[model samples]
Target: MKKMLYFFLLILVALGLAAGVGMWKVHRLADSPLLIRDETIFTLKPGTGRLALGEQLYNEKIINRPRVFQWLLKIEPGLSHFKAGTYRLTPDMSVRAMMTLLASGKEAQFPLRLVEGMRVSDWLEQLRAAPYIKHTLKDDSYRTLASALGLTGPEQVEGWFYPDTWLYTANTTDVALMKRAHQRMVKAVDAVWKDRMDNLPYKDQQQLVTMASIIEKETAVAGERDLVSSVFINRLRIGMRLQTDPTVIYGMGEHYRGNITRKDLETPTPYNTYVIDGLPPGAIAIPSPASLDAAAHPAKSNWLYFVADGKGGHTFSTNLNDHNKAVRSYIQVLKDKDAQ
Candidate 1:
């Protein structure tokens, strides 16, 4: 009876040792590196079971051992609780690390940049071309999209969306993204309008946005924005026509190629600042917040005209004669460059 008891005790010890080895092997497999050389994007779909995930990873060549991955999932409680979403995988990532990332629900985000000074049509094209965005707009018309967004005016959607790098995940709708951008723009406009400088020429918030858009298109230089705003504000104060060329280009619509002619400037359109007495009917492009602020508080200058200098900036003038001289100088600079 004592011998039988000793044999049973020895068997128990061997079984215990085997169990420890099995646990160590499973843990090592869990920490094994994934089979990849470069950064990769891994998408785990919803309703995918753990067993299926292991098999999928094996089939995609992201993992070498499907059985071990399945075993790891079964052994580790955290690995079994991963959610469905897109995840970025690096070559240095271990299988355990990948599982932890999915469990954390940190999905990859993509960026859509709505650049400043671009028209609504350009923004629409940008939206349609962006990957992983769900397109829901029935038609990309100004009036239709405006109605969809609950806006009630002709071309009301123009310049309503803010220009920024909007981040979104997979399957995010385009209209949803646009709504977020519009909300941000509304907040920015309201803030600028509330604290606007007193006695300005703007009749309403819309006019302010219109002026801001013009300011955005007038110059890309940071120092020139407020100065450009001053020129337009002074023009509006003196009942002078805001003969800006950007407005004329916007008025030309699809007819504008790479250049503008004197006839094009002479033609009358609602957006033609050369012909229109005051501000245009609506915004020409989406304006940056800096441009909006510049429009609200123009620089304290008597400047009435501006012409582009050769060095990516504008030369401001307070009189038509000085503006003509600046234009002549700009032309001479161009001629010199051509001669060179």
Candidate 2:
């Protein structure tokens, strides 16, 4: 009976050793990399319980087994408080690292690429259209929008907002987005003003904003802004009309179709650069930082004219003779292309 008791004790000891080894293997696996090689955008929805989340992790191939994760969650204290938000997750992350990331509550951000050179109306349309944004702009009118945003002094809402691919959280509001963009523009303009070149045609920062808007509309090419800015500055200095077609289009408001007309150019409005002696009463579009800088510190050039080169860019000239030659070449290029 003593020998039988010793045999049973040996069996129990062997079983205990086997169980310990098995548990050690499970712990190692919990710290190991997952099967997938790439990172992905993962969303942990609100009200997700541990079981559901473990299953989700398994389904996404983020973990080897849902049961193992579920078992771990049952033992982990204070880690049950997982955050609910979009996350950029990698399968290579260990189970422990994943849990820590989820628990920390830092969500991945999305971008709203408000392009450079869009008008206030275009910016407004984008603001209202974002699914993630909660819009509070009560009306589309300039007066209504200005009042709602607490913007003082200007009835017009043209170039106050900065253009950028603004990063945002899920709960970002449209009004908040606009306000931030406006503040950025203000800061940028002020910074540029302090470092402005000697004897710029702008009487104030707003005029510089107006000039920058013109420069933004004139060119999207990186190298062309300085030349275009110089031309406008020279024109402004010599009491020459800007004669830019964008001003005419802006003046037309909603009446502007796909194309401009001679009558449209002839018809005078506050934004018609051809009729207006200097910068318009306000900006026509949201200008970029580079364009703003270019306007504030125009290139030292005698260039007074530029025209579209019938390609993606413009042909700049220091004199009317060269400008007319460029214009004729541009027209001929268009005619030749049409014939082909």
Candidate 3:
């Protein structure tokens, strides 16, 4: 009976050693790098289970040891609770690292770059074209989109949404992204308006945004923004008609066919600064932060006019005579270019 007891003890010892070695191998496999040459995107759908994940990884050749992966998950059940989303897997990532990333629920972020000075319609086209964004807006109309974004009291939705590179996860709704941009715009406008230089002609934040939008459309030059802002502010202070070409173009809308004619400029629209007094009804396009700052704190000058210098900037003048001279020079430059 003593000898029988010893034999059973020996069998139990062998089984314990075997189990320890198996567990060690499973851990080693988890630490090993995945079989990939480049970055791979792993999309795990909703309701995906650990067993299915292991099998798919093996089938896709991302992991060589499906059995070991399964063993690791079984041993550590916490690794099995990965969320459903698209994960970016790199060649240098180990099985354990990948599992940790999946479990952490850090999905890959896609960028949608919305440029400043573009109309809302232009941005809508980009939003619709961007991949992985869920289209939930009832229609592409400005009123519909504005209502969906919970925008109130704005007659027009042209410049309500801020323009920036917005990052989002897969299946994020369009309205959700737009809301983030709009909220950012609200905060930016409020911050700038609060600290704005006193005695500015702006009656409210809406008029401030309108001036900023005009500044954005007037100049792309970083140095020229404050100067452009001064011109419009001076005009507003003196009660002079803005007569800006961009406002005329915006007023024409789809009727504007590339270039504006004399008749088009004479035609009155709500946004036509030539016909409107003080400020326009609303913002014409999304304004950049720099433009907003320029509008809030214009350069201390008596400048009332600016015409594009044949170069990629504008020449500012305090009088209509100098402005007309600058405009003539600009016309001459265009004529020279045409002649060339």
Candidate 4:
């Protein structure tokens, strides 16, 4: 009986020792961080089983062993509740920490800046090169957004979206980003529209925006914006055509190539202020806040015409004959400079 009891005690000691060793190994494995070299993108497919996820991690070398990951999920089933989305995984993450991140489904984001005055085609090209953008902008999406914004006719989504830098995760949808950009623009327009000066010639905020957009395309010199605004306002008050060069350029369309030609001015298009009697059908480009402000409250001036001097500044004229002389002088100066 004594020998049997001793043997039983020895067996119990060995079993406890084995159990302790196993536990120690598991604890070490759990604490160890998996070393990864390159950046990896992990995607959790819809309804992917826990075992499959474990296997994927093992194959990608994100985890040392599949069984350990599987065991973790089995013990804590709640860890399998990770949402389906794209995640940027670092190689330096520990098995336990990685699992926790996967369950949270939070991903790193890259920011892209959309500057004002960019065309829709330019915007689309930018989004295509962006990381994790996944989907392309459909034709219908632009139409849908335009319709919602109360814009009609053949303009499409050209100048409607407001330009701003936005943060987006790799898993962000294209539609979501576009919608966000539109919302930002709408808010900006509304804020500026509310602060506009009363008794302006424009029928509403939209018309003001349209005029501001034209001024934005004409020049980037902030000091000259109010002056330019005055020129347009003066023309409007006198029932004269705007005759802005940017409008002619817009009318030329693909034929514009780069520089505006005399023929472009003579040609007639809806946007060609050289031929049209009033404001263009729509905005030529996206305007900045300062341009919008200048449009809202123009500097009270009688200037009706402006010609760019060889210098960065422009020479303003109060009458047509003065404008003609200034143009001639500017041309002569440019020629003399070129000859020299």
Best by lDDT: 1
Task: For residues 1-340, write the lDDT of model 2, one tens digit per residue.
Answer: 9999999999999999987865665576668876668877778999998888988888887777676566566667456678998776786787777777789998777788888888878877877777567767776677777887788755346888888889887767887888898888889988999999999888898888888899998898889998899999999899999999888888899999889988888899999988879988888888899999899788899989999998889999988899999999999999999999
In terms of lDDT, model 2 sits at: 0.84
Q: Model 3's lDDT to the true fold?
A: 0.89
Residue 161 of model 2 has an lDDT of 84
In order, the Cα lDDT scores of the candidates are 0.90, 0.84, 0.89, 0.77
| Rank by TM-score (best first) | 1, 3, 2, 4
Please, what are the lDDT tens digits per residue for candidate 3 over residues 1-340? 9999999999999999999999998999989999998998888899988889988889888999888788999998888889999988999999999999999999988899999999888888888999889999877788888788777744647776788999999899988998898888989999999999999998889999999999999999999899889888888888898888888888888888899888877888998887888788888889999999999999988889888889888788988899899999999999999999
lDDT of 2 at 175: 77
Better of 3 and 4 by lDDT: 3
| TM-score quality measure for candidate 3 | 0.88
Q: What is the overall TM-score of model 1 with all chains considered together?
A: 0.93
Estimate the overall C-alpha local distance difference test score of candidate 4: 0.77
For model 4, residues 1-340, the per-residue Cα lDDT tens digits are 9999999999999999987876665566667887578777787788888888878778877777677666666656777787777777776876667677878878767788877665555676688778888564454344654655455643635555677788898767766787787677678778877887766778766678778888787777899888899999989988999999887877777788889877888889999999988788777776777788888878889999999886877899999899999999899989999999
Clash count of each predicted structure: 0, 0, 0, 0
Clashes of 3: 0
For model 4 the TM-score comes to: 0.80
Top-scoring candidate (TM-score): 1
User: Model 2 Cα RMSD, Å?
Assistant: 3.6
